[model samples]
Target: MGWLAAGDQYEVALIEGRVAARATSGRAAGRQLKSLPKALRDHPEVDRLRRFAEWLDRHAAACVAQTDLWMVSSLPVPTGLLARVWPDEAWQSALRDLAVVGDDPDEVGFLRDATEAGELRVVNLDGETVRLSPATVTLPHPVLLPDLDDLREFAAELGVVQKVEQIHRATWRKPADLADNATTVTEFSGGTYDSRFALAARATSLGYRVTGGYATCRVRDTGAIVEASVWIGEPYWDDEVTTGGLSWQDLDGRTLPLREVGPVAWSEGMRMAAALHAGRRVEEGKDT
Candidate 1:
C-alpha cells in the first residue's frame, strides 16, 4: 500500500502484480507536520532534538490508536529509544531486524492480541523499534498523482471477498506551498516525480496491503523505518486518474480531515474488502 497526500486530500494505493506501491511527486498534501525544531533535528542539537523526538514519538503512539509510527528516515528516532523498547539482551538482537514484512495475518493477529495485553509497549527486533499505535506514512513531498484504483471486481474474484459493496469518492482541497524542492525532502530515490513512485513493500513478500487502520507495522531497515503499505490480495489498476499535492497523515488512528483522509480510506477500504473475504470463510464452514 502507498499513500500520497494532495494538499488536504490524500490517496492510498493498493497494488498487485508487477506494480508495487507508487508515490509520484505532489501526491500527498504537503502539510507542515509537528516536526522537531531545527535545533533538535540533528545530533548536535541533542537537547532540542531529544525533546522534539520524545514529544513526536509520544504523539505518534498516542495520537493514532492501534497503529505503529514510522518516518521516511529512521534519523528522527534515536538509538536511545531502541534500548528502551526492548530488553537489553534482546534489544540488540531485535534491533538488527526492522524491515517491512508484508501483512502477516499472524503479526496482525499478534498486534491485535499484544495491544490487549496493555498500553502496547514498543519493541526492538534488531536495529529497529516497533510501535503498535498509529503508523506513519512518509514521503519526500506530496504526490500530485499517485497510483490508485477501483478494484471491486478483481477483489471479488479473489474469493477472499464477497463483493465490492461500496465505492466512495471523497475529495478536499487545501492551500499548499510548492517549489522546485523542499528542505524537508532530505532524500530522493529512484522513484519518479511522475505518476510512478517507489513505494513501501513487504520485505518478505510481493503482496501489498492498504488496510488495517487502527495500527501500522513498520520494520526499520538501513536506518529508515520500513513500513509495508500493501496487504495480501489487493487490486491495483484503473484508468481513472486525478492530481493533487502529497498529503500527510499520522500513523496514529485519529481521523484525518477529508483531504488527508483519502489514504486512510484506502487502508480502511482494503480491510473491508478483505473482510468480505473473511466472511466467506465463515459461511463455507457453516455449510459444512
Candidate 2:
C-alpha cells in the first residue's frame, strides 16, 4: 500500500500487515521509523490501517476454515474455482502445499499454483513440477490417501507446511475382525469429565456438533452420508458425565452395523470420539 500523509512530518502505510511510519522531513527524512511515531499513534491513517489489518486476519482465518472443511469432506473442487481464488493471498495460503488428486485418482501431488486459465501446477512425489488441467480436483482426507506416509516424508524433505492440515492428519482404519452384528465401538467410552457442560464444551471446541446427548460428526462416505456420534450426556444433565460408545448412523437415522460403515466415515468417527476422550479430566501429575 502507498504511504499516506499522516501529518506534516510523518507518512504512514501498511507494511507486511503492520502499520509503519516514515519521517517525511527533518533528520530522519524518508527513513522508516523503528516504531510508529507518537503523533501518528492516533492518526486517522494509522487507525484505518489497523482496521484493515484486523480484517485481513479475519479473512485469513475464514479462508483456512473453509479449506479445512473442503479437506475434511474430501469434496471435489472445480479447477475454475481454484483459479479464481488463487490470486487472493488468504485463499492461496490456506491451499498451498495441500495434497490434491486430479482426474486420475492414482496421481497425487502437492499443490503449488493455479493458473488463470484453470490449470494447476503441482510437485509430484518424484519432485518434478507438473501441470494438470483436470476439470475438478479433490483435496482428499488423509484417511483416503493411499500414499500418506510417502507424502509425509516427501513434504518433510521439501519443507512443505500446509495451512490446512492434510497429509499429516491423524487417521484410523477399521479392523477386519469386527463381530458381525456389532453396531458400536466402546474403545473411547467411559472417559470422565467434570460436568456435562465441560464435555459438551470440549466437543464444540474440537469442531464437533453437540446434538441431543451426543457429540456428532457427519461425513459423506462413498456415496452415502453417515453421522458418527458419541454420547456425552443429556442436555439438562449438570452432574459429571462419561463418554458413551461411539456409533454410526445412516441418513435415515438408522444405526449402521460396524461392517457397513465406510472407511472414511469410520475413521472420522473414531477420530472425533478419540479427540473427546483425550480431553477427559485427568488427575494432577498423572501421565497423560
Candidate 3:
C-alpha cells in the first residue's frame, strides 16, 4: 500500500526552456515521455476508436438473434439487409459457411459472401463459387437443404454449430379436423438425427419450447389450440436416443383425450416423431 501511494505533488517544470515533470517533495526524478505530443483525447481517431469498440461489443449477440429470427420464422431476408450488415465481422461469421437458398429453392449452397452489388456469393456442392442475384435469400430448414450430408460433413469439419434452428425446426402441414374419437400412435425413436441434441435443436429452432426433456410446440388444431410434446429422453448426446412417448396436452399439462386432440396436433406430433425417428435412422446409416 505504501508503494502504491503517491508521496508528493508533481509539477511540469520548464528546464532549459523544455517542459519536464518534476517531483515537488524530492528532486527532479521524472524521465521524459516518449514524445511530447498533443493530447489524443479530442482527436478524430479517438472518436473512431470509441465507435469501433462499441460496435464490437454489440455485434456478435445481435447477429445471433437476427439470424435466429430469420430462420425460425422462415422470414424472407432481403439481400439488402444481408449486404448492409455483411461488412461487420460478427454478421459475416454468422452468415458465412451456412447453406443459403435464394429465389430458386432447388439451388442451395454455402454462403461465402454478400457482395456490394447486393448479390450473394456461394459455394455449391461441386465446390464451385457462384454469384446469385435474387431479390431475397433464406437460410432454409435443414430438412429442406439439398445435399445435407455433405453440408453436415463440412460443418463438422469446420467445428461450427448452427446458432439458428434450420435443421431442427418442425415442418408444418395443412390442418384437418379429427374424427369424434380418433387416436394415433406416433413414434420418434428412429431418425437421421437420433441424438437428444439433434431432435431438441430442430424443435427449438422451429420455435418450439424445450424444457425438462420435453420439446413442446403449440399448434391450432381444428379451431382449437393445443400443445404437443415429444419425449427426448435426456440432455446428453448418446449414440442412440430411446425417447419417451409423444402426447398432446392442454395448457395445464393435462393429457388431452384422443377425441379432443385435433388433426393438426396429431399431424404435428407425428411429424416430430417421424422426423426424430428418421434422424435416428440416419445416424445408424439405415437411410444412407
Task: Superpose all Cα atoms of candidate 2 onto the true structure and report the RMSD in Å to 1 decimal.
Answer: 2.2
Model 2 reaches what TM-score against the true structure? 0.90
Worst 10 residues of 3 by lDDT: 1-10
Q: Model 2 lDDT vs. the true structure? A: 0.93
62-179: candidate 1 lDDT, tens digit per residue = 4222112232122233333433443432223222223222222122101111232222233222222355432321211011112213222322333221111121122222325434
Point out the higher-scoring one by lDDT: 1 or 3.
Answer: 3
Please list the residue runs of candidate 3 whose C-alpha ends up more than 4 Å from where it truly belongs after superposition. 1-59, 154-288
Candidate closer to the true structure by lDDT (higher is better), 1 or 2: 2
- Select the stronger candidate by TM-score from 1 and 2: 2
Candidate 2 pairs with clashing backbones: none
Q: Top model by TM-score, which number?
A: 2
| Span of ten consecutive residues with least summed lDDT in model 2 | 279-288
Could you tell me how far off, in angstroms, the CA of residue 198 lies in candidate 3 after the best superposition?
A: 20
lDDT of 2 by residue, 1-288 (tens): 798999799999899999999998889999999998788889888999999999999999999988987888889999999999999999999999999999899899999999999999999999999999988999999989986898899999999999988888889999999999999999998889989999999999988999999999988888788999999999989899999999999989999999999998999999999999999988889833
User: What is the full ranking by lDDT, best candidate first?
Assistant: 2, 3, 1
Q: Model 1, poorest ten-residue lDDT window?
A: 139-148
